[model samples]
Target: MKILIIEDEEGLRESIAEYFTEAGNICETAASYSMALTKVELYRYDCILLDITLPGGGDGISILKKLKENNYTDGVLIISAKNSLDDRLQGLDLGADDYLVKPFHLSELKARVSAIIRRKMYNGSNLLLFNELSIDLQAKTVKVHDTSVKFTRKEFDLLIYFIANKGKVVSKNAIAEHLWGDGIDIADNFDFIYSHIKNIRKKLVEAGGNDYIEAAYGMGYKFTGK
Candidate 1:
């Protein structure tokens, strides 16, 4: 799962990001409202950790308003030092799924995130199965007909992207944006996209899995599952 931590406290932000990353989740941080806004607008996260008090011009509530206005229905968890009933109620009214009082244990936060993701993405299920392939999201492992399949960081990311957008034609530009973000500007072309896809396909098939990726000519690639 991809997560965005929008907190002003540097130490707390790093601690949260590191904890989540060590648990096999992709995590990013933003110390100010503006930086958090930029990340929220550009990418889709499974969950967002927002802090009510910010260093910049805007607060987390305003950020939540913008996200809702843009139709971002993903799970949002507000982490704040304020323990007032009105504050919690206000955050909930603004569409936040969960609220956590500050100085909480990291384990509790992780549990909340897991619960939110399972509810939103899997209807409370932890396993994702597609044909002969199964992904144990909680365990951070993939298997093909009970046989384990190992994947590198990029390869795992690419596979997850494909599974998430299965049966749809995903363009190379979209893939580049999701995987490398703005870093793609350094590349002259999308040759790296093709290379990664080729390698991923080869590995999956070599693991006794069926090929599901289809070339879309001048467009890009599609995971048809047929």
Candidate 2:
């Protein structure tokens, strides 16, 4: 999943980012409110870990407000040190999916983020079904009919992203940004995207699954699922 960590505490922010990234997630971070706002406005994430207090203009609440104002559906989990009922109520009322009080365990945070993403994408279920495909979100496994198909971390993530947005055209730039955030300095080439898609298609067809992905001419690729 793609995650945005909006916290000003350097140590806490780094720890969260490291934990999420190690679990095969793309993580972007902001040390201040301005940076957080810029990221939320410019990109989308599966979840946003927001801190209520921030330096430089607006606070986390304002960022949450912006997301609601723009009707962004990204799951939000307010990770604030403030454990006051008022703060929690305000965050939830403004549209945060969950609230995690500060001084919490990383495991708990992971669980909350997973739950939010699951609720948003799969209606709170861990299994995702499309045609003959059965995806076990918690196990990070995929099966076609009764045959198990193995996928590398990135391949698996790309597959989930595709299936989640099935039937919609997804641009190469958007895919790249989602997988490797705006921080990475990869060279200006999208051959890697084609290669991954080709691999996915090959694996699915070999496993008696339908070829759901299609290149949309000069635009990008679309998972038609048809």
Candidate 3:
């Protein structure tokens, strides 16, 4: 999963980022509102952890409004010390999917973030199925025609990204960002992405799966599942 932590507290932000990264996720952090705004404008994320308080001039709610203006469709989980019912409700009203109060357990935070992503991408269903292909989100397992098929971590993440956006043409830049976050320089990464896709196709074919990934001519690739 790709997540952005928009928080001002250095310790808490690092804690959250480290926890997620250790779990094999791509996480980016911003400690000030200006930094957070720049991130939101430039990249996409599976979920965002937004803090209402910030040392920078702006607040988290303004960030939420910008997301709205940009038609950014993803999960937003508010993580703030402001635990009043009104604050919670306001966050939800502005389209946050979930809320987590500060001083939270890391385990609980992970659970809530998982729930929010599932809700956004999988309609809250943990098991994803398309024809004979099945993916168990909790287990990180993929099955083809009822038999288990193993995938490398990168391959599995790529598969889910394709399925999540299914028919849409996914650009190479988007693929790079999804798999690598903003940590890597993907400007000249066509060869890298091509290799991964080639391997993914090979593995699926060896597992008796259909040729589902379709090239979009000059565009990118699409998951036609055909």
Instruction: Report backbone clashes per prediction.
Output: 0, 0, 0
Choose 1 or 2, whichever is better by lDDT: 2
Per-residue lDDT tens digits for candidate 1, residues 1-226, read 6788999999999999999888766777899988988888887778999999997789999988988899986689999999999999999999998999989999999999999988887778888888988887777678888889887776777887888788889998878776765456787988888888888788778889988899999888898774
- TM-score ranking of the models: 2, 3, 1
Predict model 1's lDDT versus the native: 0.85
Highest lDDT: which candidate? 2
Q: After TM-score superposition, what is the CA distance of residue 40 in candidate 2 from its true location, in Å? A: 0.6
Q: Candidate 2: how many backbone clashes?
A: 0
Which residue pairs clash in candidate 3?
none
Off by over 4 Å in 3: 186-188
Worst 10 residues of 2 by lDDT: 179-188
> What would the TM-score be for candidate 3 when compared with the true structure?
0.96
Error of 1 at 25 (Å): 3.2
lDDT against the true structure, each candidate: 0.85, 0.92, 0.90
Q: Rank the candidates by lDDT, best first.
A: 2, 3, 1
The better-scoring model by TM-score among 2 and 3 is: 2
TM-score of each: 0.86, 0.97, 0.96
